[model samples]
Target: MAVAPPTTSQNPLQLELQALKAQHPQYHVVIWATYGGSASLLPGARWIRRDTLSISTNRRNSWNFTYGTHLYDYYVIIEGKFEYHNKRMKAADYSSFVASTAGFDFGTKQSVMRPKPEFRADSWMKHLSDDLLRHGPLVLDKQLDDVLDDVKDFLEDNDREVVMVMLSFSSASAVYEAGKPWSEGYRIKYDEVPDHFNREFKKDMKKDKDLYTGKKWPRLGEVRGKVVICRGWDVDAEQDQWGLHCRLPKWEAAHGFTSNIKPSALAAHRWNELVGDFGKQDAPKSIVLAACLHHDPADEESWIPPLQTAPILQRKAEEHIRKSTKKTKHLWIYGDEMKKKTNMAIAKLNFLGSDDVDFTRPPPMTVKSAPVLLVATH
Candidate 1:
């Protein structure tokens, strides 16, 4: 799991998102924070390519439109880079409120200061209390409703490229908590237990054992409007560890990162993961493929490095596996040029090749490998 630090505006946008959830309780709003400045707070970032970009809400979420329930009022896309901070602190050990000592105060006839002299009682406990108390947990100057309104406008305005997806909390915890009905006070009430489980024991369990044949992955690759499958688990290239090569067996993952797994396992595994829409009735199996060039252990960038473009893509396109291509059960991304571009951290799925549509032809797994490339920003 690529656990990034909480972005700078996380708290503020979170508070605003909570308020928006309270207001709109009809659709499933999925907010996709791209690289930076989440759409819920910052405006004019992500956008959809269309004639006139405008907010469209479907009161009757249905299949006619093909868009999920109109479920999400829209897509909140934050298309910018991010600066992640690294902090390893446990809440259990830290004090919530620290009271600064007298050393911080400005008083007449104060004692002279020394390099490492500690005479005053006010040091760790009472240092910087004024700023800490004044600023609060996070900067909370903006109104929740106002922030949401800005998001709504940016999404509907249709001029910007960045857009936000607005939906009902009926889908996720954030929305549900934000939209909880409140009469007297803002603290709304909610029933966390899923609604589908009521009035039945284990009856609600799936009847088909093979309902989801493939694994649930952390990363997803969309190819020609379908889901693309990639690597498997079991990084160790050992005989005993080779069993994870099966697609369905190693599908349960947080990120689409299975490159390090043994080749033997990959041999047995057909698909790396499932995506684009799994359970939908009319969902298609369209998949795309890409390769992260630096996946090789010898590649210095594989561990500690910055972004740079070289012959990596060409190298990838030239040597894509073919035996894997013959069994095109799903989209196979093997071209050497399909190098790792994005490192969203769901395992090794960093390649975001150019969005080239190949509905008529299959990927390099069969014979000719298609080259798609994405630039690594950070």
Candidate 2:
């Protein structure tokens, strides 16, 4: 008696097994196992008992076995006692065991699959850092906007009655290169300075279209009136020479330091001028200075301390308004200390308030001890 060949009308399991084999021609045998055990059968059997079995025929197809408990009981024999005894072995382990018993070889041991690129934390960090480095200016501008927003929130939190907003730069020539004067005497006149600054500011703003369009100034609720001043002065006397006549004299006098002054003194002078511009009626209770100071790369001996400048400037501002009835409740300095390079060195100060100083006494003056020249010895 001869047996008939398997046809489409065969049992569903056999047909499915045949299709699986046909789908993965590389896989010689696909061992499908089902655990036939109950939770009540053993004390800790549930811990090892998996709801479904995991099997990968190839890289593309992963098979999950979820047939009824008795489907392969006769052949596989993984019933109550058998399942409890072999609970430690997983579905893949069982497949390997059966394959080894029948003298078949699967590949090396399986490894835990890695997460997708988007799901990885380090990938997100790398992407953000790369984007920031690529678009440095735009990212810095957005950060400035965020800083301004925080300043606005801070002012609101304090419930300041009168607010003053001032933006001052130590060296305007550093930022607006085209606006710098040709020579010392031929410097751009004070009258032409505003036009030059406006032109340069507009040009720079136009360069990046995605810059923050919102109001850079903070808006206070209770204040009847506010003073907002944005001014930039040239500090590089050797390069532009305009700063010598334009604002350097005033800066030197107000700075109270020697002619050869540090960037911190220049910054302090600028802050004093910003605060002194307003009269008694509009004197501010809270002051905000967004100061931009230039760091000379040639002078390696001197380092720009972005942290200390705010307090020094605040002291100068307090002294300037000492006689007035209005006292400074808050003074925030958001400083950007930039060096002469392709990329700017940004230093940010967030919500730094002023320190109380005894202004009735005279301001401390630094006495620069002159070098004593010894006469030619006898």
Candidate 3:
């Protein structure tokens, strides 16, 4: 008889769930169904018991249980094979039920689901190692290549010329270096052309040869498109490793622009300048593609409000392209802090269509009269 592969009694996922519950006693941990092997391993976990309870009843009872008390601040939903009316309940249904019971408005709370680990710990670690290796510069290069390929296809399909502009901070030196090898692409210095409209400088740029290939830079009128990379001005690459230390005053001064001039205006001005330099009468319908980082400062000392430049640039580009054959698109990659800052900045703009879309506003505060610990098990 063939022997089956040996299996361990301990499940990695169960251990994670147990640790999560232990670390956060304030959260209400709910397992949707009782069928999963790991569900019973979680201590102090609540069972939905969908076989015996309806979602509406659960909602009503949960509210009644905590109506006059403060039971849990948040709900952490765990997945299991749940069924209702002989139909399998989806993970989304569990999330929706929890959201409704917790009185969480749509999009207020993000789901906290962990990725399923491999059966063996070693296998899981190897998978994680591979994932880490695939990220960073390699992944960024692939992403840029994909975007450029798509843009090229679009240009061919539409018979249009485009100018792809990439804006990054001095901190993203790796990304800047990775993009340096693209054909007809060049990095622009902060003070190279103080006056972009200067005829002499424009003429000089047309005659400039690539230091590597000895090929003259493509004039906007001669080619389908060109890539221009712009780095944050006056930011020390050595000091600001992540481009988080950029000061607004220094940035404005570097560009010789007045204080408080929006970064979006500067970006638009650059785009127009590029268009004017390369634009031909026959190719009036030009496309602009911008990619930039959205940085949110970690402290007051390092705060850079101009990091919220992406959305304003988008709005300005949209307005400029309206009723014209020109097209514009932008991509902003941000982290958790960046997301919060950008949302707050956008909220302050007050240009959003609906009051319901307030991102910076917090939910109404309530008083906690009593504490409740309601833990159910299979």
Candidate 4:
């Protein structure tokens, strides 16, 4: 079990923005990914959940962000979960195909000799590429479509210009790159990227014939009101390539923290350790951090206290920049505590709106005080 200490700090959101304004003094766009707590706290940014803008709020939305196209036109895609078959085929069929090609499936089902009319085995790359395309971005295309559409809707709603010109990287991008292909028995794709499959997918999508001719998939600069999807690896050949940032979180992953430590205390400590990495030349101009203040009440493993998340993330961000001797400027965004509280309260009320509702009182909610620091860093 982990414990956390307290720290006093002013409003993290305000402090972060003031620092950005003072440091950049020019237009900047941030592409970030974090949990809801941090998303809601972005100062001038708008918080649009993946569903609120793309589909019905009833569906789970993964991506959330504030529109900053006025400053930057690029879409720095970040961030996860659950599982579905990418081949969209039944297990038996995939097993049969694999057995016919690999001599056995899971080393159990042997490939029997075919009947009189036999055939040559398909190229190994053929089978491999098929599986990769099906399991990779192809399966994710629809969900990503929803995200892109939501961004389009925001642009339309606000009448902002759309363009994706550049790509940048942070340590988070490295985490994503670290995701190797999911292969079980032979360990075929461990820590390896199937470049051939990715290139082939891109080539097929770019074609002007058949199913590719008319699709919602945003092609590079092909349509109006659509933004290009840029990968961090594509930004610069030498430095911006995919890899982990120097600062690794003490926790398992940055997605959610579940220890008994108070949210603020945990965030402050993590920031203290990670702030130095902000000075890296390839550090993101804008960071999308999972708001520490917003924890899933339903997530029993997560031990976040009310309001501590936002302040903790904010404090850590400020400290990251101030302590760094490198002359660099950036902004960090996380969730808003008050907004989360309002939303959480409303959700509770909605749960009881039904006549069949047996529950009366809402779930437990609590708040704790954290030490604040009044000194300014210039």
| Candidate whose lDDT is highest | 4
TM-score of 2: 0.25
Q: RMSDs, each prediction?
A: 20.6, 34.3, 24.4, 20.0
- Give per-model TM-scores: 0.24, 0.25, 0.21, 0.33
Query: Ten residues in a row with the worst lDDT in model 4?
Result: 369-378
- Root mean square deviation (Cα) for candidate 4: 20.0
Top-TM-score structure, candidate number: 4
Model 4 TM: 0.33
Q: What is the lDDT of residue 341 in candidate 2?
A: 15
Query: How do all the candidates rank in terms of TM-score, highest first?
Result: 4, 2, 1, 3
Kindly provide the TM-score of model 3 when superposed on the true structure, using C-alpha atoms: 0.21
92-204 in candidate 2: lDDT tens per residue?
A: 43332221111111110111112233323232223232212111011111243453343344334433222222222322111112343312111111222453664465355
| Model 1, span 1-378: residue lDDT tens | 001112335465445444434543321222223222333334222111122213333444322222222111121211122222213322221221111112221110111111122323232323222211111111122443444344344435433222211111111111112243311112212334344432231232123221111223211121111111221222233421211122211111112334354323332232233232122222112222221111222233331111221123222322332212322222222211111222111111112222222312222121112122111100
Would you list the clashing residue pairs of candidate 3? none
Could you tell me how far off, in angstroms, the CA of residue 258 lies in candidate 1 after the best superposition?
Answer: 14
Candidate 1 vs candidate 2: which has greater lDDT? 2
Tens digit of per-residue lDDT, candidate 3, span 234-285: 3343422221121221121121333354556555654554333122332112
